[model samples]
Target: MNYTQNEKIKQVDEKTLVVGVDIAKETHYARTFDNRGIEYGKVIKFNSTREGFESFEKQIKEIAEIIGREKIIIGIELTGHYWYTLANYVNKKEMMLVQVNPYHVKRAKELECTK
Candidate 1:
């Protein structure tokens, strides 16, 4: 997806989960942020298989239930066929899956290190 820099205020609730996921060839890495963009959990690592999906669903569901959330916004840095499986799983789970550019990841990492 084409991305352009834009400044806007993001209003999020305490239960909102903004997730950044790094999908690998056989595994994935994810970090979750709360409404205030605060890191509420540690980086979660899981495989890229049915078992992995099940585990992820279990943990995410538990978190959502505890926080009373009905929606999950997930982002991953992969495109085309590479993300089909993950996107399909997200869709099956009724979660919102968005394609994130790797450039954004690089920028975020830069911002994180400087902060």
Candidate 2:
């Protein structure tokens, strides 16, 4: 299902923990944050393998529990085909996975640097 920006924003509430992932060919990095954009924990680095995915899931769960969040929304950049396996893993776990545009991300970063 497609959601407008407002609708997507509405899905993230106080009970949600947002995780943004930077995808790569071998290793992936993740950062955790809350609805208000307050970051939590250190950057999580994991390999692009089943064991790595399992470790990533474990870390996410632990962070959510610590932060008292019941819902998780993981956003990953649609970097070529590097995200496919991770996306499937997230889907099997019944968690929400959002694909972000790389171009938009680059522009956003540029804008942030200006500010």
Candidate 3:
């Protein structure tokens, strides 16, 4: 399915919790945000193992419950080949996982650094 930028933006609503994950070879970092781009909690650092994925899942669920959101959309950066296992894990856990473009992350990092 193809989605325009506006269509993609419209998917997130007040009942949604968006989690962006920075994938790495051994570890990953994640942050949560609401529909309006307001961050919800601290950065979570978890390993790439099954245990790590479980922990990440718990964190996401906890945040959603705390914020009273019923939907979760996890966005993961497409970094190397390390994402397969994590993707499978997330899918098995019945949550939506969206692959994000690395270029977008790069540009965001550049903007962050300059600020």
Which one is best on TM-score? 2
Name the candidate that leads on lDDT: 2
User: Which regions in candidate 3 have their CA more than 4 angstroms from the true location?
Assistant: none
Backbone clashes (count) for model 3: 0
Worst 10 residues of 1 by lDDT: 3-12
Q: Write the per-residue lDDT of candidate 3 for residues 55-115, one digit (tens) a residue.
A: 9999999999999999999998876898898899999988988988889889988998995
lDDT of 3 at 55: 96
Clashing pairs in 3: none
Tell how far residue 49 is off in model 2, in angstroms. 0.7
User: Which 10 residues in a row give candidate 3 its minimum summed lDDT?
Assistant: 77-86
Can you give the TM-score per candidate against the true fold? 0.78, 0.93, 0.90
Instruction: For candidate 1, write residues 35-70 as lDDT tens digits.
Output: 667765577778888888888877766766766766
lDDT for model 1, please. 0.72
Model 2 / residue 32 / CA error / Å: 0.4
Model 2 spans with C-alpha error above 4 angstroms? none
